[model samples]
Target: MLSNDWAIEARGLVKRFDGFTAVDGVDLSVPQGAIYGILGPNGAGKTTTLRMLQGIIDPDSGVRRILGADRPHDVAHRIGYLPEERGLYPTMKTYEAIAFMGALRGLPLAEGRRRGKAMMEEHGLSYAIDRQIRQLSKGMAQQVQILGTLVHNPDLVIFDEPFSGLDALNQGKLEKMIRALAAGGTTVIFSTHVIAHAERLCDEVAIIAGGRVPFAGPVDVARDRIPAQVRLETRHADGPWRAALPPDARHEGALWSFPLPDTGVEPLLRALIEGEAGILSLSIERAGLHDAFVAIAGEAAARALGQPTQEEAA
Candidate 1:
């Protein structure tokens, strides 16, 4: 694995399309061997930021460093990029397609072919290696492209919605491969609108909204940014304890959710006991990253589009 150090850095990054800013002033830092997740709703500039980082698009203003290189082009051969949209030559065989992509990044033809073959086997596409891209299943085709992205063994890898068209089985495989990449010292930055994927795989995450970052940090740290709200089930449904909760607390059926200002599991328990709320079952329903993302991005969307937030819409 890569040594524990900074692998990617960006500061005051800005990208505009005509008068519309796709990415506003933003800062990002990803550490070596880290599976950093970039999360946001659609049109929130996640792809724009990633494109700038990959040198597919230049920022209007801002600086980016990849693997100690000031310019992404300087380290182009050392990084692999998988855009949200895909490309494949329908006439080419899977092996041929992968080899061509690797070769474009300067890998020797022989090495690319060898690595491509091995990857096909590893990803369960060995039987389809000789088949033309047009003949393979959509899942098979996607795997072929994914394998192509990794054939050259890049030190830094970027994937946009890597799990977009995957089913549960292939999604599991991709998750395993991502972990393996980090284990082997690759710095992975992937963007996805799915919160569960990032919660399960990312060591650190950035939640973006309206082309701006609202929260960025380790998963546990990001959890802290949202208040702790829990559900408690008491033995006595009609207990007087309901009267003890603050007026702001919510009651749904027999479950009570008290929104604590901070994450204090012990004090929450103590407060329940002090209130004489017979705790038959107490489940901490901490606000998920999705909830937090919606809280931040939804508000921005409200202002940007002059529309109600999802909650307000509901």
Candidate 2:
């Protein structure tokens, strides 16, 4: 049984390559049995941070703990890691490749092979057990690698860009697999720049930009950073209510849009009614993760990273 409340923790993490600082004072607190996401664009130091947490590379400063162990190597057997790059032997049979990964993590060859076969059967890949990896499709090959990562049944799993090369259907499958892992009491952490995946899959997320975290916490909290918006359309475009509208209000044809005030929309509604404006339509638009990302990371940064500012997928 795990005694620690947090599955992974890091503080003041700093990684410097020569004079260039890749990661600067980044901190994280991931809860047990939860799906957490480390989000950032390419070259934003996400991989460097993950490397430090997994003990593949030591941080220049700060401390890290994984599965209640201060030394990552001490709990290596309890953690399963899938790096961004796929390195399975092309000539190895699918089952052999999975069993080999488990063996490296301390499972005996016979037990590893047994678990590998069971895992493949459970995931609907039993038919490919004897086929060489090179003969499988890209998606199938990636799935095999993921199964290998879990062949030892580790308590915590870390994936770097798990959805990178997957098609929409395969990405959906990976998302369901991640949720299933968490439901079965595994702490799952994955890094991705795609806000949509994090929005759909993570219980909590940390937004990393330029080697710094501007926001970290529950997904709802990040979304709450930006106020809701109110869009209104009236028959009288030149009505007195137009004067009552906020300065930021924008007009496009008959529609006027602006951020809903923190005080609420009651005042605006009353003002519109009093001005005798013909209310054609009025609706509130809640901010989503994409909007929150833009609000926290800046529109320019979001654009430069090729992330959509609106709810639309990038």
Candidate 3:
């Protein structure tokens, strides 16, 4: 049984297509009023797991509870789901489309339209409310669909690759909207292959690799799996302080970069000063979600996914 404090709970979820397994014994727990993310590469079974949670597809074996209900339909009206594939009636007016989606989720047509108009006004899309979906720009169309998903004011919202196909400006807007949703006590779960998005927006995250989840926890905890690093630059490269440098230190130009030793930076600073090394600069770089994902999911899997590394993103 799932606790009332949890918005979503899944146990031992397994899904197979023919002889190939898409998800293998996955478990997930999303707390109420939290923004959770599922991070994975393409074909990493992220969509499969989300589909099972929404009851769009059944797991071959497992139990899932949404809003404390064992059956999805029992709480269908409370969930707002934006699928990976965007589906909107191209000929329908933006406001009409939003109201129609809300109607499907059990909202009355009149109430749906009223809420849809309000949402458009709030999102600065009131000017485009009567425009046909096909007439809107890609970003506008995407935003319209998202507003539709929220028209009924669902308590739990799930977005699959919401950042995909969006420009940087639109991506920033979506991120703000997601944060606002969580702040308003909605449990927001999103799946993204982009580590940076997950790092910036998620309170907790689950990393999926090759149909299995190897790490699931707070974003800071994930980042802690990798060590912190320090980059030092000095005029004297071959001084007595060299002995104090870590074995993995690498020289690039005048800078020496290496992981910060567990013993701490104070000892290294003392050694450098004692050796009279002219310290030009010393900076510590903390490991981020991208580093954690690469460390936990393995470099090979990360490479195969072709997602940008943290350094590259930076």
* lDDT (10s digit) by residue, model 1, range 8-78: 88888899998998899878889989999998777989999999877788999988878887777888898
Q: What is candidate 1's CA lDDT for residue 206?
A: 84
TM-score of each: 0.89, 0.93, 0.95
Name the runs in model 1 displaced over 4 angstroms. 1-5, 237-244, 261-276, 299-314
Tens-digit lDDT string for candidate 3 (1-314): 55666899988899999989999999889999999999988999999999999899999998989998999888999999999999999999998999999998999989888888899999888999889999998889999999999999999999999998889988999999999999999999999988888888999999998889998889999998988989999988687888889888988978888999898999999999998778999998999888888889987667766866555654
Candidate 2 lDDT at 263 equals 72
Decoy 2 TM-score against native: 0.93
State which candidate has the highest lDDT: 3
lDDT of 2 at 201: 94
Superposed model 2: Cα runs more than 4 Å off:
1-3, 309-314
Clashing pairs in 2: none
Per-residue error at 231 for model 3, in Å?
A: 0.5
Give the alpha-carbon lDDT of every model: 0.82, 0.89, 0.90
lDDT of each residue in 1-314, candidate 2, tens digit only: 32367999988899999899999999899999999998888888889999999899999999999999989999999999999888899999998899999888888989888888888898899899899999999889999999999999999999999998889988998999999999999999999988899999999999988888888899999999988889999988687877778899888998988999777989889989999889999999988888888889887668766877664542
Residue pairs clashing in model 3 are: none
